[model samples]
Target: MTDPLLTTAELTAFLARDFEQVKDDFTVDEITAQGIKLRLNVAERHLRPGGTVSGPAMFGLADVGAYLAILSRIGLEALTVTTNCSIDFMRKPIAGKDVICDVRLLKLGRQLAVCDALVFSDGDDRPVARASLTYSIPPK
Candidate 1:
């Protein structure tokens, strides 16, 4: 396995500097050979009328987690964009708890990277959502 090109601190800093709007919403918990672990701190804004975490909120976490996982291996490519994403909302996420996303990079090629993310509510062993993402890496 190859060493990660970006550390959690570096990825956090990059998000803060480039994506300030969501900088506070996400925390990079760890980066490993498999992929990255991210936490989404739940807030009032992320809740739904049903007293559960909203789907869009979870989707955002999955997307960001996948992006960071790819960047960890390929280095920061700001222009790298999601080419496709398919997500399944398996279960409703608990409110008032942080959502954790375990992202795995399944494949990385010259022009694209494929990843999968499993999102779980804090303290829960079951996944609430699953996402498969493909990103187009910008040409150097």
Candidate 2:
């Protein structure tokens, strides 16, 4: 059977305010037993010329989603740091759409976590970017 997911309220409280990025820009729209749904609040700063979301902005979404996934499983371990990340920009994103990131834990170990993220522009079904990330969680 699949493991149960930790709620966003639990995660936010666990971080003790250090994870402001998640608080400020993202909402835990859904957390099923399998994974999570992270919604990004897009703004003008996230856009590039010709009205596409900037690559860096997409990268940030992926990165933060990974972090949130780790925290969801591990609790508010603010010291967990990104050790590696690989991102693929699959396609240009539509500016008006809110970016939704789906994050799943590939492996959750005692001292580390690996997550995969698929990011999509809100209205469409296709992914705009994909990322795999590893985070180091300090031993308590």
Candidate 3:
């Protein structure tokens, strides 16, 4: 198979340029043929009342992770937008730890890319949440 269009550094810069809101909180950990791994540095803002990572924080991790996975293959097509997302929070995330999401591209077609993501509390083997997302790829 051919190599990905974007390197980790390029994707990271794209995030900083186009998605400033999340650029600092998230990071690219690894990219391979099967998928990409992203980490969300769980800060105080990500915590809920009970000191657990909030649902929205986890969703953001999944969303960004999946989006980056698609971009890894297709390059920085900034207009590729999420058209659908379904996420399930299975358990509370560990307090004071970062969250990691591994994303697998289910399909990469002409107009759309679909991804599956699993979010884990850093250092844990079990996933705390899982997400399925579909993004609309912009026309060239």
* Candidate 3, superposed: residue stretches over 4 Å from native: none
| Better candidate number, 1 or 3, judged by lDDT | 1
Best by lDDT: 1
Candidate closer to the true structure by lDDT (higher is better), 1 or 2: 1
Q: Write the per-residue lDDT of candidate 2 for residues 6-89, one digit (tens) a residue.
A: 787776565446765546667777765646778887888788998888888888888888887777766667788999999999
Per-model clash counts, in order, read 0, 0, 0
Overall local distance difference test of candidate 2: 0.80
**TM-scores of all predicted structures:** 0.97, 0.88, 0.96
List lDDT for all candidates, in order.
0.94, 0.80, 0.91
lDDT value, candidate 1, whole model = 0.94
TM-score of 3: 0.96
Q: Which one wins on TM-score?
A: 1
The sequence of per-residue lDDT tens digits that candidate 1 reaches over residues 21-77 is: 999999999997799999998888999998798999999999999999999988989
lDDT of 3 by residue, 6-107 (tens): 889998999999989878999899997877999998889999999999999999999999888998998888889999999999999889999999999989
In angstroms, the error of model 3 at 9 is: 0.7
Order the candidate numbers by lDDT, best to worst: 1, 3, 2
